[model samples]
Target: MANVIVAGASRGIGLELARQHVEAGDRVFALVRDPDNAGELPGLASSSGGKLTVHAADVTSDSSVADAAKSVDADGIDYVYIVAGIVGKMEPMLEPGDWDTFDEAIEIMLKGPLRVLRAFLPKLSEGSKVIAFSSQLAASTWPYGGFYPYVAAKNGLNRMFRSVAIDLKDRGIVVGTIHPGYVQTDMGGPDADITPQESASEIRKLAEWWPLDKTGDFYKWNGEPHAW
Candidate 1:
């Protein structure tokens, strides 16, 4: 069984990913902002027969990430899933009042994974995978104008990880970004395309078949290649 890290595993896709991985017999280190506040993660851990462990981590904070990193075993984590992210409300670029929302999006969606990488990269070994929970909105294939900050941040994240993949290739680590569909979570809203579980399920299948040759590529949840 693989040792996996699921950042933002308290809820939604992150939570589902942790659950599914645990059910699949993997040892999971699930990171949430507050383990006490995590609705079902503690319960999952308690019943997981030692397969799952919850750790408190705020991806936007360096100190918090560093502290969380200490809890993970250095015995080689097989997968690091960076699933913590946020989306801001649609706002026109001409509007000058959405700075806070935009800032929050950038902090969580862009810098959050970078923080995770800085702390957890050493935990990964050769042939390990680093999967970022990115979005199709970042893709140039389908240009979207609104959501000034969210789109920009996701695009920035995609580019950053694209370069990181190259830097880590010599180590035989495979890195890629994935758009987890328009998941039916708080961020995706009620009328979104698919449930969090559905997206997580497809992602699991993709991860199982993920080729090292496809490192640095972007993909949809269903294993479809997505344009950068």
Candidate 2:
């Protein structure tokens, strides 16, 4: 079985991803901000036949990310899925509004994934694949406006990991970003287009065979290429 790391596995898409990985008989390292209060992840782990582990990790912090990776104690990781994220406010905010939303968005969306990847670098084998979820709004081609902070952060995420893919190419690491479709999750809200299970399943399938040639590319939940 392949070794997998699912950061942000407390709930939503991350939790679903962890569950699916365990069901697939792959080794899973489920990282969350609070292990004691990690919702259903512990229950899922208990049923994983010892293939799933739960670790405390605050992706916004470097020390926490490092500690979580160190706790893995694995020879190498085959797949790294960075799924932790927060939704910035949907509507426009004026200058009077607090900048915390924007700050939080950039920190968790832009930097969190990179920090996790950096800390877990030593644990990743030659053919390891790194994947992260990006919003379609991040693309310049997206027409609908609003949600500036989230869009900016995700835009940065796409570009940052693309650069990472280039730098890690010689080492045989593949990095990719995907728009998970409007997944039905707490963040995506109840009216989203697809269930978390649907999104996660398709993502796993695509990621499993995603080639080194398309290392820096973006894709949709159905495996279609996403325009930059």
Candidate 3:
């Protein structure tokens, strides 16, 4: 069994990823913003026979990420999944007046994962896999002006992870990005094409079949490569 760390495990795809990892006999370290607020994860972890541990962390906070990183005591993490992000109400990007709304979106969607990767890199072993979430918006241009910040942030994440993969390749750490499609999560809404469980399962399959040489490639949940 491998040692895995999943960020944003409180709900949606992250939660399902954690559940599937535990079921696969992997030791899972689930990081969430609030332990007290984690609804079903705590119980799920407990039922997994001590295979899972939840750590409280706000990805936007450096100290919180550092503390959460220290909680994983294994020799090194085998996989690190960055699944935390936010989607604001669909509106024109300029409608928000470019202050708190844009700032929040950038922090949670872009800077947050960068902070987590920086803090946790040292804890990952050689041959480890780092999978981060990107979005379809990163590839396709949207005619709507709204969600500009979200689109830009995910594009930034994809670029950052690509660079990370290049830098870490010789060390045996495979860094890559994935788009989970339009899943029926809180963020994805009810009209989304897929379910969280289906998305998580596809991710697991990708993880298992991931080629070391394809470290920097971006992928879809259905196992197809995505355009940058």
Candidate 4:
């Protein structure tokens, strides 16, 4: 079975991805900000028949990510999914914005993916696939406006991964971004379009089959090419 790492797998879609990989009998390293408070990840690992390991990792902290990456006792990682994010303030630009949350969004969604990638590079083998979460709002074609922090962070994340895909193309390391739909979860809220299970299921398929030729492209959870 393939070795998979699901970063920010404390709950929601991240937790669902961890569960899916564990059930598939793949070795899964599930990372969270607090292992002690990682909700179902601990129990899932306990019952995963040695297929899952939980580690405490704060994407905002370099040392924490490095330490967590060191805990993955594997010869190579086949997949690395960076799924940590914060909704932050759903507001338009004001004279004085919520700078703390805005800063947090950039750190977690933009810089965070890069940090996780750097720490896990040693474990990633050729042909390994890395997918990070991006939002439809990040697309330039999307005309709607609002949620400045979330939109900006996702935009930055998409470009960063795109550059990475270009950098790692010769090595056959596929890198791309996915918009996990408007999934119904704590972050997506109740009025979202789909459930977490559905979103994760489709995303799993993409992670498995998304090609090197299509690397650097952003896609929807349903496997459709998303607008840049």
Reference-based lDDT, each prediction: 0.89, 0.91, 0.88, 0.92
Candidate 3: 10-residue stretch with minimal lDDT = 89-98
Candidate 4 off by > 4 Å: none
Q: For residues 91-209, could you state the per-residue lDDT of candidate 4 as single tens digits?
A: 57777644898899999999999999999988876789999999898999889878889999999999989999999998889999999999898988989999989999999999999
TM-score of each: 0.95, 0.97, 0.95, 0.97
Per-residue lDDT over 62-128 for candidate 3, one digit per residue giving the tens place of the 0 to 100 score: 9999999988888788888999988764666554364676678788888888888888888776788
Evaluated against the true structure, the overall lDDT of model 1 is 0.89
Model 2, which residues run further than 4 Å from truth?
Answer: none
Report clash pairs, candidate 2: none
lDDT tens digits, residue span 152-197, model 2: 9999999999999999999999998999899889887899899999
Candidate 1: C-alpha RMSD to true structure equals 1.4
Look at candidate 3 and tell me the lDDT of residue 60.
86
Give the TM-score comparing model 1 with the true structure, all chains together: 0.95
**Number of backbone clashes in candidate 4:** 0
What's the CA error at residue 77 for candidate 4, in Å?
Answer: 0.2
RMSD of 4: 1.0
Query: What is the clash count for each candidate, in the order shown?
Result: 0, 0, 0, 0
- The TM-score measured for candidate 4 stands at 0.97
Task: Give the 10-residue window scoring lowest on summed lDDT in candidate 4.
Answer: 89-98
Candidates arranged by TM-score, highest first: 4, 2, 1, 3
